[model samples]
Target chain A: MPDRLLLAGLEIRAGERVLVRDGGFRVDAGEVVALVGASGSGKTLSARAVLGLPGPQPGVVAARCSVEANREVHEPWSGVSEAFATGRLARFRREVEARFRAIRGRIVGYLPQDARGALDPLWTVRRQVEEALALGRTPGRATDWLARSGFRDPASILPLYPHQLSGGMAQRVAIALALARGSRFLLADEPTSGLDPTVQAGILEEIRATSAEGVGILLITHDLRQVHRVAHRVVFMDTGRVVETLDAADMDRARSPEARALLASTARIAWRAFA
Target chain B: MRATLLAGSAVLWLVLLLGLAGPFLPYDVVTAVDPEAIGLAPSLDHWLGTDHLGRDVAWRLLMAPGAFVGPGLLAVAVATTLGVTAGALTGFVGGVLASTIRYLSTVTASIPRFVLVLLVMTIYGSEGWLLGVAAGVAWAPALAEAVHQRIEVLTRAEFVLAARAHGIGSARILLFHLLWVNGRRMVGRQALLLFGYLLVLETTLSYLGGFGVPEPEPSWGNMLAFEFGQHTANPWGLWAPAIAIWVTVLATGIVSEVFAEREHA
Candidate 1:
């Protein structure tokens, strides 16, 4: 009911094989909700569905992909998709897709899993951020966005191409571009996956600060430690479905066997590092 | 490599000047076919000597470029635009459309392009524009396949995926990112190769006669075919167009290579 992003009853299918079944989650304003799962758990697919993105394979239908934002509800396939004729469904999809396009970037921005690879190799940092700003019609300079993402000297960073930047720097530039859209919510997918711990902590801190500024974040990651650090709530997924949703403080109390196993694995890794 | 590129480019420029401006040159290839001056060796009155028709070989040689250059440009433009667009679009929006394009391209590609061009010229007549268009259509399938393959490989690249995820529209992605950014080298290379191919094709058809650039048009093909037997009388007629074709094709190839090298560097 609060200003939030909601996705429910989402089903993604490639032909007859189901990828994600009945995936659902919510992130209210100023809250960080981490969607955590092992590799191949369909976390990214479900997140992409809210924006009406089809999978790489054709006929990867995303049905009942419902998005709620700014108190308006948008369903890509209203009611039962199977109930409508092909023509009617196609028309309905077009209508919803337009709305999804409008919501994307402006209302909800997406951060790709690979930060360095995701930044356009040909584009300068300034150009990339400016494009995002231009697309959202957000009035601001690239330097401001870069500064907000933690760059000390944004002008120096502006002229540099993606390859010139270190991995952490590229990630910050990506974050700047994502935030430059004036996005109210962000879908950060594995934002800190390949960074050193110091840089990881810095990025987590940036995410926390962004949340503090009232941006609802749906963080998709495999790191339970990251969930403990910045998330208000955690959604545990296995295979393709959400298995558990629990408060960050109560992750230790999660009862799902998959959740406990994941916790145990993280715990063992942490113990080995300390030992 | 540098010297080859420079020499090729210089020769290319002179050839293009002759081909494009041949009609306006101060010599009459059409009405100057004097029977008295037939097969005259190179002299101050007639540069490069007189051909079997008694027309100045230099004038006819200059006019010859128009036969291939114009049609070659047309073919490259048509083929690159059609081929790149179809290939990139289908590859970007995969599934049924991609499969259909691939299937169609495969079928079209199996038939030799020269054969198809021969059929088109036979049916449509040997007009330059018609030949250009026919050759463009004949060549588009191959260019399309190359572009499609490039797009398929880069379609999943993280930058492309990120652009989509950020809500950038398909047109901008295809135009700016795919074509302009990542695809310029390949497109440029393909366009150059297409133009070279078209030049050769046009020349070959004209040389074959009847179904190519008609008589009095002064194509390198027909000139070579007509004057090669008379090389003993005047060698320049045979050498002029032959050297022109060689220089043009070599220049295009070298230019394409240089462009690719610069892009990589």
Candidate 2:
């Protein structure tokens, strides 16, 4: 009934080993949902599964996956491997890839980790943003998106390439590129991980602002503080599963050992900041 | 590196200029042979002396650049097109298709290039352009392997993954972003090296006679062939084309080196 992005019953396997099992989350329009966990806790893998990105290994498969966006449902991986069975792996991959391609960037944008390095080095910032706009067929200026991403002098930033941008600036440009697509949903993976505290706050503010504009966002990060800063709901993952789900404000009330440990780590840093 | 690059470029440009001007020069390899000037040493009247056939060696030497460069460019073009296409496809489309493409390239590359070119030329009738085509076909597999390997690595790069996340089509990403942006230096270096190889192959074939730039065409190879058995007191006729091939090939190596250095930088 509501405009939302949902992935449920998802399982990602790399060869014989399962990387993510039974990972599920939902993000309603205008809400910021954070997938939080420690490193190698399947946070990134789960998010990447949602995008249908291939795993690092050759035999990687995302099975039992179900995704619903804007009320249209797709069980892209369900019965996919079984139906093909053998001798048609390429066809199976193509069909699933096409399904995801139809929604990516146009309906669901992504801001990857290492946002600065993710930018095309050969292109200027303006051109990259404009390309996203053109691909999404969204009617807006690159300057408008840049401004929305917190660049005050969008004109000055436009001509600069990725190499010319500082970490904070490149992160902003990456955000602008994701936002320029005018997608109903966005997935940001560790958007402010390497940024200084001040720049981190600025980037989080941009995420909050985008959510306010009625775009549902799934913010993936290990930092619980970032979740509290911008997210409405937090899905805490451990190993390969969603171990806990709690309101961002209720992080202190977390019951799962994994979520509690994360909370304690964040508290130690917060106390250190005060001391 | 900068000095070498500059010097190489200058030499290449001079060769290109002379090659371009060779056709319009007064001394013609076919028609302007003089009965009296046979094997004359380098003098005020003739620069680079005269060949055994009484033709000015300087004019024939000028002709070799166009012969080598024109075919070398064609070879590079063909090789780059085949290599990049095969590589991009192999990288982008994984699974059995990728394996098959890689296998085919390996098989193609395994064949000796010189022998393959010789066979193709023998079948197609020996022409300089045919040499370019055969050499390009033979050399392309190496470039394809390089491109495929590069694409395999680059497809996993943050920039490429980010582009994919943004819903850019695979073809555009492969061509514009992968090959053009990240892989251009690799392509350029390989292409330049292939060009040099093609030049040497052409010269070797032409020198061996029968199936190359035949007769009065004045390719560096055939010129060497003509001057080799001569009893001329002047050795410039032989030295001129040999030195030109050496210098031109060295220049190409220099350019390729520059591309490799820039890539590392």
Candidate 3:
């Protein structure tokens, strides 16, 4: 019943433009939260803030971001986002890196939007998975972890480098590496954005199954259809602010003007696809 | 696979070793001047003929390789170390520091190497060790600058950045991954370059009366400088030491080229 992560009155600024303002949200344990918005709606910035990855030059105003688990606050550095404004980002980076190292593989997993670019070209798939495990200091057997991640032939997959694998295969390897660290919170930034529909469905389903295992997921994306299928709650962002937050199940019959406008666009796109 | 080429290299190395070992050989007759054989042309008694001083030119030629080999190698070793280390650090760790070192390298390299060697020899009193030091000083900056440029390009590579992200220590990254990996080709090239330069440096210094002590100590360069007056009458006097210097430089150049090409391939 407690929140796993909470961002209160968060404001993220890049130069003079407020990328995200009055952005407050939370993801509860074992919950899937979808962040839906148009491009430049600050959905990505909000998600990045939650993970403590600031933009190139971000200024945060009036933020109280916290991550709690087991009914106790895991991270409670009030006004910590102010570190970005004071030109202390480097120091903040070191602190975040240290904390991230401690919790990254075991407590948090990240699936970045640019899946291919995130992987090392020289390293084989298996070595990367092993590196993730070693980096996180995870305890469970590596073989069991690989099997659960849906890798059919761990032996063959392990030796092939990133360039040799297809987009879907590489994404699967990325997910495997993220999970290999035994992280409980999976931050998936458009996990299926660049994949074929069938492969996308398979990846989304894998994400769903993984989330069911007490791992909370914060899915940052603009696809309302994906939100409908996998998300428990929907947080709508507009012009760098959270315009609305509602139950995902009630989104279909929602009557708010912004919601109606979004739904109309989605329906139009869906109709065109079927035609 | 190439037996003849490998065998040829081996034979060349064997000959070089024998030439180098001439002074230390058990023969007590090195530099034994026979006044009776003075100015004699090439014959069975005095192979390669006798010098103006009546010394056996064959023995002197054999011993000449030892003089060049010792100081030449010492200069190469010093130059290689100084150049590689300076170059690697300057290029890899760029910024104001790199700029400063690079600037210094450029200035030193721009000075005529012979002039620099002469200045160093004059300052240090022209002893054999001083000559070696002068040669190293004259050659190291250029070689270091070359090495620095190579390492700078490699440092910005994505693979290096990935390695850094993995939390590998800087020393290991530089030495094992960056410097060691990229240094083989550069060092090979520098070694060959240094070999040619050493011959020239030694030759220049000995010609100027800066090599070894006074006479009776026969350096190839000193012999050439002294025998130039009699060269037309006795051409072998100049040919013997000149040929030795030429062959050594040529062999090193060939080996270096082969190494450079292999690295490129």
Candidate 4:
């Protein structure tokens, strides 16, 4: 199988502040890549840059950024570099919008950090999921996907707006909506941040099961426990740079000072719980 | 609840319509002064008694809704279109354009509405169209200011941003979605409020000798103005037209309040 996404030296900046410096990673088909970092560590920015959320800043340069998928090399997702060099950000924005429309619901799904904010308040849960499916599929197929997204009582949910739903239910609806697009890559930023531990585990299990079914996930989070539970590959970032990458199995044996420190802290916490 | 409110307003509106239409049909001539009926008081022949001019008070009351209601409705329509459109556009397209329009509307609104009406009457000569134009000019700025504020609130809503993100064109978003969906309430409320103001403005204009051509034509305000001197002799002469104005304004208020409540619900 081909790699779902390949990034080389992806750089991001916000005005004069260099938020993400020379970040590069790839998720092969059917892989879950957990990007673990502390808060303000550019993990979210990297994900946002990949998803083409905010346009890039001036004077930001990307040395060798390229994204390849399905054996076709897409134009460099270097929004900042283009803004600085060509001053054609408006044209570039149109191109990005067009590209996003084509690929977002078809090949890439984005799970924003705030699940409530991700959903429209006025629309019912099922309608939101239906909208996501409609973006990429035939009407009949979209209905089928909505049904399969764990909505057994789709009729009831279809009429119940977002405010009426529980937080966990809302997050599930967000996930279903994202998945309904039939996207191959899921960029989930803190998929279970505000949920209780039990709900978080349940959500993580769903994410893991979904990833097993040919979905490549770039999981942006700060939870080390979650990293241990579901990550197939680990990319540790610090201060806007990808400092280390390791197999999930070999994460304990990693020697980079930052990685070792993270592992050691997590180990102490685990041991303390047992003790 | 909504249905009940709407039904009640509909009934009130039906009554107003009947009053307006009652004059055009074969009824006692409103301005037919019967000298023989002078000081005759309410009787079988004159249901609401005769004015000092010996005109049937009932006929005058019946004719009152027609003269004012047509012009009021017309003024409301013109003012609403101009006001809401200008307001929605200015508010949605913020910055220099919005500020300039806002400033202009403020200046217009700041001037006494009666002063503006007098100015318009001076220029346009108190014909029915001029009456409507005068009332509309006086009313538009207030309605526009209201619509502008409402649009400003809706422009910041998430759905609008989402619509933009969907690559929907600005014009479609403003017209098909924003204007009707979010703006209907403000416009409806303004129309009702303006209806009351329209009555008062028309009455004021007539009192100042601005409405109707010469003798046959009669306005409720003109009748009231004529009867003001006769208050001690026959208060009903003044009271009849005064009551007409009061009922119309009250009906307008009730209908508008019901509409606003339903919209919020």
Maximum-lDDT candidate:
2
Q: How well does candidate 4 reproduce the true complex, by DockQ?
A: 0.21
Error of 1 at A75 (Å): 5.2
Best by DockQ: 2
DockQ for all candidate structures vs. native: 0.51, 0.59, 0.12, 0.21
Clashing residue pairs found in predicted model 4 = none
Q: What digit string (tens of lDDT, one per residue) describes model 1 on residues B159-193?
A: 88778778787789888887788778878888888
TM-score of B-chain for each predicted structure, in order: 0.91, 0.92, 0.86, 0.87
Q: Which stretches of candidate 2 lie over 4 Å from their true place?
A: A55-95, A272-275, B1-31, B41-44, B119-125, B228-235, B261-265
Q: Write the per-residue lDDT of candidate 2 for residues A1-275, one digit (tens) a residue.
A: 55677777667676678778888788888999999988988888777766777622244455555545566766656555554455466556667778778777867788888887899876789889888888878888999989989999899999988888988899889888887886778888898888899999998999999899888999999887788789999999988889998888887899988888988988999899999
Candidate 2 lDDT over residue span B110-135, tens digit each: 88988889889888898767878888
For every candidate, give the share of true A-B contacts it also has.
0.66, 0.81, 0.02, 0.02
The residue ranges of model 3 lying beyond 4 angstroms of the native Cα positions read A1-3, A55-58, A70-72, A79-101, A140-143, A254-256, B1-265
For B1-265, candidate 4 gives per-residue lDDT tens digits of 5675566577458646854685564444776778777644677887778788888777776666566677777888889888987898787887788788778888888889878877877886777767777788778988888877877877776555434433344676677556775567668878888878877777777766744423456667787877777743456777887877776677677778876775554
Ranked by lDDT from best down, the candidates are: 2, 1, 4, 3
Give one digit per residue, the lDDT tens place, for model 3 in A103-164: 34355666777666556654567666776677667766556676777777766777777777
Q: Docking category for candidate 4?
A: incorrect
C-alpha RMSD of candidate 3: 6.9
Interface RMSD of each: 1.4, 1.4, 5.6, 4.4
lDDT tens digits by residue: candidate 1, A133-201: 998788889999999999999999999888889888888888888889877888998999889999999
How much native contact recovery, as a fraction, does model 2 achieve?
0.81
